[model samples]
Each structure stands twice: as C-alpha cells, then as structure tokens.
Target: MTGLSTLGRLAPLGAAVAAVAERLRPSVVTIENGSGAGAGVIWSADGLIITNDHVVPGDQARVRLGSQDVVPARVVGRDRLNDLAALRVPREGLPAAEVGDSRALRPGQLVLAMGHPLGLSHALTLGIVSALPTDDDERELIRADLALAPGNSGGPMVDAAGRVVGINAMVASPGLALAVPSHVVADFVTHIGEPAPWLGITALPVVLPPDLRRRVGVAAGLMITAVERGGPAEAAGLLPGDVIVAIAEEPVRHPRHLLEALARTPAGGDLDLVILRGGQGHRLRVAPARRAPQADVPPARSAA
Candidate 1:
C-alpha cells in the first residue's frame, strides 16, 4: 500500500513533465549545416533562432521547424566570444520559448533540456542545476548535472515551469553540462549587430595564494600577459604581470565574465578595475573601446 501511494504521488509529476516537454517541442528546432547538425531555440515568433556559434559556422544553414517544415536560415549575427549565434528563418507566428530569469535560478532546482542528441529528434533530458555563478568565482556558465551530447549544443534548457533558462552549451565532464544563461542570451539577442565592448588586454586565469586570497577576498584572478599598444588598457596604466580580480564591482574569475561585464557597460564609459600588482591590490579606472569594424573574430582565447 505504501509503494502504491508513492507511485500514485509520482504519476501527477510525470504527467506534468510530459506536458511541459510537449509544449517545448514546438519551440525547439533542428539546425543543419553542411558538415554537421545541432539544435536551436526559437527565440521569437518572427523566426529569430538562437544557437551556438560553433553550430553554425557558415552564413547560412537549414532549420527544421516543429511542423516538419524545413526552411533556409541566414546567420544574422555571431558572437564567437560567447559562443552564441543568431539565425533568422523566413517564417512567422512560430512557437517561441518563454524566456526565464536565469539569475533567479538556484542550485538543486529541476531543469529540463531538449535537443536532438545523436541524431535523435526532440529528445528530452532531466537534471538539476548543479551550481550557479558565485561572487568569488563569477563564471558566466550555468553548471547542470545533465547529459548533453554533441547535437545538444544549442537547445533550450527550461525549468519545470517550461520557461527557458539557458542554452545547452557543452558537456564539461561526465554527468556535468554547461549552459549559457538565458540572461546572457537576452543581452546577446538585443545587441546582435552592435560592436562588443573591447578591453585590449591578454590575460590568463591564475590561482591566488592563500595570503593574497585573504587580502584580496578572491580565490583567483586573471594575470595580464599583454596590453594592446595605444588601447584603453595600456592608456589606463595597466601593465603586464598585473592580476585583475574585479571589473566594475563584479568579481570575474574567467575571461568570459570580464567580457560579459564589458558588454553591459556602455561604450566609452568609465570602468573601475580592481587588480593586484606585486602582491598589492590597487584600483584603476579605464574606458572600454569599441571593436574595429571586421568580421566576428573570436576573442583572444588567452584572455580579452
């Protein structure tokens, strides 16, 4: 009788999950470039689709909608730094995923991911938010304990309420997946063609010593390896070998976090940076410059 009661209680939850998956199926899409295939999310009813920049390497591809309709899609904008790309299909009144506040997400909360994994169409996977950005770490990616395959690169990672919270990005390890938070997606979508703010510096993540960590109140920092000549960073007196701990009051443990903070700041606006030089902490102000007019080049991987 106890077992029967437990099953009865689970029946409703299973039904609810099924219902959510059904509703999301229409918003998830299959993207196919000449070399390979991936998944995407219908970001708008007017045919704007969101996927990983790695998924669509070319200017054009094919999008398969829920209605089994296949249409040509043009790559509208690509942010290789964030690994996000926007595509536009020639369709309207499409079912679009409801955006959710990824900042509101908490660890251990339930999440559902939809994708066409391993050529399987519209597959659903269940998991929980393994972790979120922390003040000391400030990674822009959402870490989830979900199984993600190659084909899952750009599908929607929705909550139990069927609201899109993230885009399935990549598998970090076995049973661990990473996602680009929906808030980041919203920002990327809003400024599709605009030049991303640039801070001309190359840096790399470095672990701070215990004494430095205690003094600086940060676990790690990005060590500046090079500063572009005549750029904002160099003009601000930033030198190589300096370790940057925070940007505009936001802790940035990764280059992506720094880039995201720069993206939020207006062009030519003053930016406050907290850094350590020779094991001593100091604050400096710099203005981010605009990227030169060119094709979307990947941000310097060493650090930007």
Candidate 2:
C-alpha cells in the first residue's frame, strides 16, 4: 500500500495513521527483553498489544509508551509458533491500527510497512505483496520486497485503508521480507486465554549448511530453528533443533504450514508436534502459554 494508500482506501488516512500511531504506537513500546528495543503496534484496546514474539521473551521487558515513560509488562499471552504476541500496556484507550482483510489481498497490491528500521524508531517503508498463496496456506504469510531493517521487528504493515495487514517477522538475503498475516494474527489473538504455550512450529529455512539438507534427504521445507524458552514446546520438552515434519498429520511443506496449524488450534490445547531430529521422528504433545507484556525502563535516557 502506498504510504497514502491506506489514505486512499480510508479517507483521513493521514490523520488515521497519525492518530493510530499516537495511540497504538505509544502502546507499542520498545522491547529489551533480550531481543533489543524496537516498535510494536497495539491491536486491541484492553492491552492486547501485538508484536513479534522474539522481542519480549520474558515477563520483564520494558514497555515505553509515547515520549519517555517506561513501565513493566508481564507475560499475559504469547503465540511463539505464529510469531505474534500480546503485551499489556498500562495506558488504556491507546490508538490501535485497524485490522484489514488478508483474504482480499491481491498480489501487486500497494502495501506499506511502518516500524523502526535500522534502529531508527517509527520509520516507514513501502513495498508490494509480490506474491500470494498458490494452494499454500494464506493465513501465515505477508510476503513483500519493501525495505526492512533489523530493528523493524514486530511493526505493522498496512493496506491502503490504513488497516493492518501483517506484522514484521523475517527478511532474507535477497531483501525478501515476510510478515505474519493479519488474519493469522487474529487467530492467535482469539485464543489468548490458554494455560499453556500452544503453538504449531513449522519448518523454517534456517541457514544450515547445504550438506545438512542432502544428508537429511530434504531439499526445501521450513525448519524448526528454536522454540520459545519454557513455552508450550519447551514445557513439553520440545527442543530447538527438532524439525517439524508435519502438523495434524499434514506435511509441512513450508514454514507457513505451521501458521495454519497454529491458527486451527485452540488456546490451552495440546498439539501433536511431529519432529525430525537426528534423522529420527517423534511426536510431542505441547500446550502453549499466554503472551505477556514487558515492564522496563531505559538504563539511561538522552536528549538529541
């Protein structure tokens, strides 16, 4: 979407993005729970702030609203599988990014990504969807070629309507960027009250040596790089090195398949994780945990 595309779809988009960023962006504090501080967008009013799960792994990350006020956020819920997470912000009625329909998303549709790229907080980037699902799971993807930087994790991607379409997740060497589709985010947010860390791990193309693929007799499929520490998979003893071969008995041909599996499951439920580790297969039943908000303050503040 054009920076103004969201403006085109929804008039007063400039005002809307501004307001949403003011409200939702404030709720999106920079996280330093080991993943480093970056931007996140508020998805709901009752403190359900959406961000990339990797940012706030622990319950003690810092949530700095607008300006410089920092607070402590606890883990309220998490979806490590889908890479979408919720954090609680102390301030109420924060501006929130509008959620748009990912199903209606068309390739080459104008899209925009807003986040802290290159450690520059609140920077905005533009790009097109570039591709779409071809019988593959749609809920798990938000592929684009827009510019992205390391610090842009957990930011929002908006449609012309200024509605959020995806959440920043990964970028490959060729500048291909991937995000969690808003619909997939909706599914995760819908089931946040679970007792365990229940998420479906999919295969990700981690940079394993080419020889590893040949030895494993697999060409290309998402590999399970790491599970959330002490999360449903961890609590269930699911290890980081394990590769997810399938979900619900369906072969996980790609990373997005894991997204489909997690979207289909309920919070507080057990998932049968089929994994390939050391060339051996195993099944593990895991329950996911609820995502949490981080509470922290800058060790020091500065004025530039």
Candidate 3:
C-alpha cells in the first residue's frame, strides 16, 4: 500500500543515480570549422584516447577538459577502412586512462558506455558485452547492448576495474553500440610512428567457407571490388575483378584485408600479389608504384 504504484516508486532512485552519473561524466572537446565545443566523457585525464575518425576528420580535432580547458590534438594516426581514428592531446600531467585487455572479456561481461551522446556532452550508460565482431583488420571489436548517441563518439568504455577496454565509436540506432577493442588499439598506439594513407577497401575476413574448409585453399582475402584507375592496384596490374587472396603469402579477404597486406608491403619494394582470376589462381611479383590520387566525391565536391 505504501508503494505508490510502479511509476511513483521508481522516480527518486532514478534521480539519485542520474545525479551521480552526471558528475562523473567526461568532456569531449570538438574543434570544427575553426570553432571549439565540449563533448563529455568518463575519462577526462590525458595521454592518448582512441575515437571515431569523423570526430577529428580534418587537419585538426582536439579534446576539451572538464574545466572547459582546450588541448591541441593531432592525428596520431587513423584506420579509415575500419572507421577508427586515434588522436593525442599534448596535455602532460593529466589523468591517463588505464588500458584493459579485451581478450579476457566474456559475453555478458559488465561494461560501461561513456561518451558525448547526441552531442549533448559527457554521458554514461551501463550494459554488457553482447558480442565481439572480428572485422577484416585482424582486430576484435566490442559490441554491446548499451545505448550510444552521436556526441558520445570517442569516449571510453570502462569495466568494473575502472580500466578502459574499448572506445565508444558507433551505434546501431535505438541502443546498440560498437567499439574498437582495446588490445588492437593499444598496439596501434605503441606502433603508429607515422601516418599512413587510408585505402578505403571492404576487406573481408579470410576464413575458408564450409565447402572449402578442408580443401587447404587460399585463405579468404579482400576481393578487389573497384580499383581506382591509376591507383595502386591499377599500377600494380590489380584489376577490379581480381580476387586478392593474399599478400606476401598471408591470406586476405576483400577490402581491408588486401590493403593491410599492401600497406605492410613496403612502398617501392617488390610486392607479391596472389590473386584468383577466372577461377584460376596466379601469383605476380611486382614493384608497388605510388598510388595516384582520386577524384573528390563527384557532384558532392568539384575539383578544387
């Protein structure tokens, strides 16, 4: 009798939790069109944080502090194929996030979502790891049931240990979120000593299909969809119809798989391309010429 129906009993507890969460949120400072604004998060401290490439797409993208302070962020590097980007702020003596290994993560493991949802500022949501999608990059990603919004792009997803396991990067409407797993991210940061071109490719994972599972065939790799004329593929004699089965003997699937193979292949060095054409396979070794530039989005932007 004392409980005032279901709705009335839930209001106060909800308000208390919201209050605490608001205070704990971090800020993601976005600099666009030469203007700066705040985006919130759970980790405000410093070092380097991984975020969506679009968050800092241009020559400049910096993060803001909880106290409304701004820090200049530069492109540490980015993986366009995966839509994952990493930026570093030069704020030393700031709080850095603790990196957690996602390898040990199990399905339904407790996880928290932190970001600038809907561009509103810093926000946090609770959920559990629903799945880990293995993209062609040979990296395992975090998939969760927590609600993620637009502004929350590039925030940290921490676990009970207060260590970051993923970066809040994408959402599938309503309440699905996907993150770049921390393990791959950590290696990226430690090794990203230089910037690399983003060869937009739909790298498919090279897993033998059921029919070919036991045949000891080529590992699935990026099947060349459309090659930019005069681009690397064209210069190297890679055709649009070519199925890039591997690079330097490593199996590849369509899209990023081939590019990854190509990227690791030194520029100007003799590269071996193993492709399937006309249901038959061929291996060609050739020097990789510089890939020519592409046209800007037609009708979207004229030649500048």
Candidate 4:
C-alpha cells in the first residue's frame, strides 16, 4: 500500500473515529480522590456520574468537568461486586453520554475508549471487541483490545457510532482491556439512589466447622458480628453470633452474597433465612424494611 493510497483508504475511518471522540469528550470527566484520579462518565443530565468503585473509594470525590472546573461530589452508592459506583454532583444540566446496548455488541466491532490514560485528558484509543464474557446469570462483559492505563478506569467505551457500550474497568493483560457492560451500568444507576431493603447487621465471612458444615450443607457462612439495635435482624430474633447459611434458598458464603440477596428482597417482604445459632440450624422469616436514607450532605454547589 503506497502512502497516498493508504491515506485515501484510512482517512474516512480516521474521520469517523475523530467524530465519535468529539461527541463523547464532553461527557467524560476526571474523578479524583485523596489517593489518585480516574475517569467517570456523565450518566445523567442532572450530574449523576458513573465510575469504578475503586476510583471513588472514599465517601466523596472531586469531579472535574470539561471546563476544568472541579466540584465536590457525594458517593450515591457502590456495587463493589460489579465494580461500579455512582456519584451525585452538586450541579445539573451536564452533558450525559449516549448509552447503547452492550447486548447488541458483536466481536470484531470497532470501538473507542475515551478517558485520561497516564494523566492525559481526552485520550482516545481505537480497537475492536475481542470477546464477550457472560456470567451464569447472563451478566455480560466486554473484552476489547484497546490500550488502557490506570487513569482509563471508569472511562466510557463507545462504539463507532459514539454510543457508550461499556465502561473500561482494567487492562487484563498487555492489550486486553475489560469493561463492565452498559446494561449492568444502567441497572446499577437505577437502583443506586433508590431505597432498598435493609437488614441492619455487620457481618464477616467465616468457615464452618467440619461437623457444622455438614449439618448446614455448606463450607462457609457469614458470621453476624453485630446486630443493629432495633433493626430487622434483631426483630427476627437473629443474634450477634448467628451464622447465615442461606437466604431465600440461595447459598450465602461471602458478605457480599448476603447483600445481593438482601437487595433483591422487596421492602416489607418476607425473607427466609437459614442460620446456625449455637450449633443449632434453624430457619427464620424476616420482613425487610426500606432503608433509611443516610444523613449525607446534599448536593449544594453548582458548576453547570
């Protein structure tokens, strides 16, 4: 391919990629915390953003808009299991990114990653979807060959049409970058601000004794270290030393597993929990109540 011939062949593709990058640039923001900084995608016009849970690890973060103006943002919610987090900025009328359906993505489809990689803002990398990994429950993930770095975490991965299909999570290897699918991001944002069921208890994962494991038919369980005063757990006669074996028939091994089960439980709905207290396994029905909103500072600043 001669240089002139190559230019003629590649110019159109280059122009398309540039257009997509331009459209997505304004919707991508820099998310900074005490430790470091990453990228975030504007998820709503009213300043709701989505980023990686690790990027916004603290209770608050500082979001820098395209104008280089920084604003304080509160952490609305985090789903560490899915490695996604939501933030509420103290502003509105922000330009949210155009989200597309990841389920419609196909291997070898052209995509672009827009974010700050190696602290370079508005960096764009082009690649094709290498694979799509699905979990047992049909949760999908995008695996691309895009070059990404630390600062690319939480950035938007948009298709050639400039529609976001996923959020760049991490570089799995030299050239493979993994992204949390867009459908999961949409679901996370929808429930992040809503009041879900709450069973007030602090617990940790614990290995069951051999005999106890046999009795509970599990290798591990969550040990309730503390039951909140006047909370649903206490109301259900759950003691601090109780070990949770299952919830709604699903096996509970990790603390997050229990949390996922609780999140699916409807407010004011009965939850059947199988627990082992004092080496005695028993089942209890508890009605989970709506979670009380935390006393966090409201969104008060404006930068839009």
Top candidate when judged by TM-score against the true structure: 1
Candidate 4's displacement at residue 152, Å, is 1.4
Q: With candidate 2 superimposed using the best TM-score fit, by how many Å does residue 132's alpha carbon deviate from the native?
A: 2.4
List lDDT for all candidates, in order: 0.87, 0.65, 0.59, 0.82
Give residue 3's lDDT in candidate 4 (0 to 100). Answer: 92
lDDT of 3 by residue, 170-279 (tens): 78657778887777566556546543433332233345555544454765654555555544456567665556676677666444444445456555566577777765
Higher-scoring candidate on TM-score, 1 or 4: 1
Of the candidates shown, which would achieve the greatest lDDT relative to the real structure? 1
Better of 2 and 4 by TM-score: 4
RMSD of 2: 9.6
> Per-residue lDDT tens digits of candidate 4, residues 1-304?
6999989999999988888888899999999997899999999999899998889879898999997999999988876666788999988899989999998999999999988988899899999999986422222468999999989999999998999999999887989999998987887787876876677777767789898778657887778887878988789898888888888778876655665566677666788999988998899988877864333211111000
Please identify model 2 stretches exceeding 4 Å from their true place. 1-28, 134-139, 195-304
lDDT of 4 at 55: 97
Scored against the true structure, residue 86 in model 4 reaches a CA lDDT of 90
Model 3 residue 202 distance off true place after TM-score fit, in angstroms = 10
How would you encode candidate 2's per-residue C-alpha lDDT over 148-201 as one tens digit per residue?
A: 887788888887666888888878545678888888788778767643233423
